[model samples]
Target: MAALVPFSLLRNYSPFMLARPFIVKGCNLNFSKSVLPLPCRRLPFSARATHDEQAAAKAAAATADSGAPTIFDKIINKEIPSSIVYEDEKVLAFRDINPQAPVHVLVIPKVRDGLTELAKAEARHGEILGQLLYAARIVAEKEGILDGFRVVLNSGPSACQSVYHLHLHVLGGRQMNWPPG
Candidate 1:
């Protein structure tokens, strides 16, 4: 049989309350208590296996593709759901579905204009390019991380840019390290 412990035994009663106790207040003290069994712990091997599977899934998702109309396109079109931070006629800033930092946001142009990657940027892309940078600043201000923030653009497979569409990553809310991994 399990032991039945009283709630009073868990803590000390206030001396002030004991001294000024009154019965003028009509209150019912009757109550019932119940104990719940602790949940079973998973086996170490099973737990490790589950963790490995999750890591593999995340890696596969992050390194999957490039230069195609990704899920972000759908998000831009309002066909998919995303936590938007800022939006203008030319640009859109939204929270990354998978955050790398406390404040991880992606800022992109509403129109691609064949800017599959930063490497493909031409002299004509100058206007929209400047607009994207300005949008990143707006996003940082809105997220309350204006004091300090980092903007990143992973270009091509070497840089681990899974999505081909041009986008800027704005990250903050923690001490940033130099020479990004």
Candidate 2:
């Protein structure tokens, strides 16, 4: 014989129109009373969101720009907190939020001007461009990776650059392999 569902579960939907019945395999066949297991309680909304979903939401919010102010602006203005390793009048170096290496730092020009990416650079950007590269070396020395390190710039979508503001990635602190994945 089929078991009758409890009134609490039945109240949420039409009992007759329900397609599938809740199956409780190991429980006793007593149907005179209703008892729900502890696991059926509602969970908080945050608990329901997966780690990937939360990361995607953060990435989406960070990349949703129309040539406007970015998180780097806040970092430059000292409005948002960042662990700065090196700073000069022309450039600033700070830790990357999602670091791919043990020692990962981002070197950027304090004044972005119109440089959203390396591809956007012009002849007038030569001075700041050199300054940024020099800052990267200073950062490597400060981080104690002077023996060896790597500098990278993801220019466009093909390179998987999520941030538009131009910046250089300085990575070290381990045996780095050639030809990055």
Candidate 3:
């Protein structure tokens, strides 16, 4: 197993910091805090599935959105075992099986209510949406990544909306690049 290097040693940012990178699982990942925050939007931003996330997207696409129950339903119903990070009456959060970041949690509504994807959300779904986003914040806080974290919602296959069920991915613990996919 790879030992964790202290973040304190890499606090001061420098271009040369890239040379002596912080090692995680044998990969040199820069945990710098120099990136700017994305602008706020009235609507949730759609996360595009990139190369690293293609497998998840493909698996999700294979299932499609035929108004069928998903694996999340199993998780919500206690049929699936998950490392739950947080849970409430309206939402449930748990660690991602295939995590993209050191801190990656998926927050979803306990009741799908036709919210197979963000695009399918109706006005009646407003309350659940707010609850989901708030739960994401709570997950970030619990994970000690509130200072810098990301909430991603992939709406469709093109955007890599895996599982059909609406879910918000709370990701942090490292420097996240812009133009996220």
Candidate 4:
């Protein structure tokens, strides 16, 4: 017998589609009636994203690679107050608003120079890219987690890159794990 998809599942797509029958494999499936169970099981934390994370990801997707001035620009210009950890001619390191680890810092270039994201990096951006990585190390050292730390760069919305400006996240202060989400 063919399986019927839940009308509830089709509600999000198109209500009119529920009356249509679709064939898959060797059986015809109708979406008007639900033969499957409702209320799916909760996924484990390691395989699931929290509500807040999901929301952030959606927001990131909306604004990904826009090439617009981001909050980091304000932080760099001193318009927005940030807990500055390190600053120099080219790079600025500060505490992250949403810390992923006990010690979390963001290392960004003072001037974006069209380096909105790592994927947008050009040959000329090699210098600033190196500087950002070096700044991450400095941040890790100053945070007293030089022995163990992780540097992460979420390139696009698919990678959860909320900020458009190219930046590196320096995280430490606790034991880290593999396959970091």
Best by TM-score: 3
RMSD of each: 13.6, 15.9, 9.8, 14.7
Q: Candidate 3 vs candidate 4: which has greater lDDT? A: 3
Can you tell me which runs of candidate 2 are displaced by over 4 Å? 1-65
Q: Go through the candidates in order and give each one's C-alpha lDDT.
A: 0.71, 0.73, 0.77, 0.75
Please provide, for model 2 over 3-49, each residue's C-alpha lDDT reduced to its tens digit, 9 standing for 90 to 100: 55444443333222234334332454443344433234343223453
Model 3 pairs in collision: none
lDDT of 3 by residue, 1-181 (tens): 3344444333332233344433434345433433322224321222442553666777787866676789999999999999999998889999999776779999999998888888888899999999999999999999999999999998877786768889999999878877665
Residue 91 miss distance in model 1 (angstroms): 0.4
Q: Measured by C-alpha RMSD in angstroms, how accurate is candidate 2?
A: 15.9
TM-score of each predicted structure versus truth: 0.64, 0.64, 0.71, 0.69
Name the weakest run of 10 consecutive residues (lDDT summed) in model 2: 11-20
**What TM-score would you give candidate 3 relative to the actual structure?**
0.71
After TM-score superposition, the amount by which residue 121's alpha carbon in candidate 2 deviates from its true location, in angstroms, is 0.8
Query: Which digits, one per residue and each the tens of the lDDT, describe model 1 over residues 1-181?
Result: 3233343331222223223322212233221332322235343336585566556545544644444566678899999989999999999999988676679999998888878679889999999999999999998898899999999997765665666678999999755766665
After best superposition, candidate 4 residue 17: deviation in angstroms? Answer: 46
Q: Which candidate ranks first by lDDT, i.e. highest? A: 3
**In model 1, which runs have C-alpha deviations exceeding 4 angstroms?**
1-68
lDDT of 4 by residue, 52-80 (tens): 56668669768765666689999998999
